[model samples]
Target: MEKKPAGSSLSKALTMLNHVCTSPVPLRFAELVDLSELPKATAHRQLNTLLEHGLVRFDEHKQAYYPGYGLLALAHRTWANLDIRDVAAAPMRDLWSSTQETIHLAVLDDAEVIYIDKLESPKSLRLYSAVGKKGPVYCTGVGKAILAYLPEAKQQDIIHQQNFIRHTEHTLTTPQALEGNLQQIKDTGISLDLEEHEIGIKCVAAPIFNARHQVVAAISVTAPAFRTDDASYETMKGLVKSAADDISKRLGACD
Candidate 1:
């Protein structure tokens, strides 16, 4: 490796991180020393600094260093500030006005769907869902919408993680049942939560795709089943799908 020129402290740390990431396997301290072209003492010192900050972790078993959970937290914080949320805001408001129902924007976290934003319903009926709260992906409209579009392996992994402790009588408590629902969502570009997560509560949801056509988040309109029969549910489905499409487009989604 060529000698790296002198640079800012932050720059050097980033370079070290990049070096470790480029390796196909976790790197030993000596390997990192060679790959970063830094003196052994300097490499050791810098790696310690990174370790303290949780940017890197040393595995006692493997005797190697790898990325740490702190970086994952930082990435999540960055995702929170992404322009996609801002882009979806106006569209969410417009959809709420048109439907006169509570709306939500959510992102998938591991095995749950985390509500990132919500616009409450104007009618007297209130729901328990609130921003930052998490619910199962196997039982909620927004949850299933995003789950259906996830890469197959990741989807299955999340399904495995689910406890399947039923929240309602209608909840899909088994993998086989949930798989069928997800397949329907993929085919229709819409997902329905038919009083599955909350009794007498239902929602219509659609997946939001990013520029690469990857499902990143979901939008949903939720209301009581008593207020919306199947006919009204169909109308809500169109509105929700349209709103989702608009947000996806603004996020640079092509299709």
Candidate 2:
């Protein structure tokens, strides 16, 4: 075996790790060697380096390599320091421009959604939701958007935490009703407030996913119910979903 420069070896190892992580299933050493297109000995050497550093782990029972907990810890650190508002700014502006509706970006906190960013519409009538304000996950578009995509266990936990306050006549006031609405949102990939959070205010929203395809946030386009006719509502739904998709892609979400 010939010695490779440290930089070259490190690059190859990182590239191999990318392949491993992107794979839909755990890979055996032989599969990784073929997938990486690296010399068998070089691949072996890189795998050992990755395992030694805790970046990768070999599953003894399955005889395959999987992402290690060390990588998960690193991912958690990366997400903790990430600013979702920064990732969503461009798309939010574009959505506001297209729909002439207020744009909001929010993330789940406990059982609620906290507004992290807001772009006001140019129109005289716009949603007055302030950044940093929190709203119930069961009644708001952005909140439901995030809640709908959560795992069933987590979703139930959050649902139980809701006070089930009837902020408006349209609000889903029961766990069963909210769960049904969430199922529809998850199926259609969109959520509608329909004046549920506040009288006269309505919105369309979509979930934003991270690299792991987990729902990390949501984006919305809000307007007064009077102006959100069926046609405009349909348009805003697409715009909000598209904006969410763009932001999700920026955060490294895959199809």
Local accuracy of candidate 2 as per-residue lDDT tens digits, 1-255: 533433588888997899889899999998987777788889899999999888999999999999877898887888778788888888988888898778889999888889999888788764547899988899999999999999999999999998899987898999999999988998999999998988999889999999889999999988988888899999888888898999999887889
Q: Against the correct fold, how does model 1 do in TM-score?
A: 0.68
Model 1 spans > 4 angstroms off: 1-81
Clashes found in each candidate (C-alpha, N, C closer than 3 A)? 0, 0
Worst 10 residues of 1 by lDDT: 1-10
Q: Tell me how candidate 2 scores on lDDT.
A: 0.88
lDDT (Cα, tens digit) per residue for candidate 1, span 45-128 = 788889999999999999999987898788667655777668899999999999899999999987899999999989866786
Each model's TM-score, in the order given?
Answer: 0.68, 0.73
Error of 2 at 164 (Å): 1.5
Give me the runs in candidate 2 sitting further than 4 Å from their true place.
1-77, 126-128
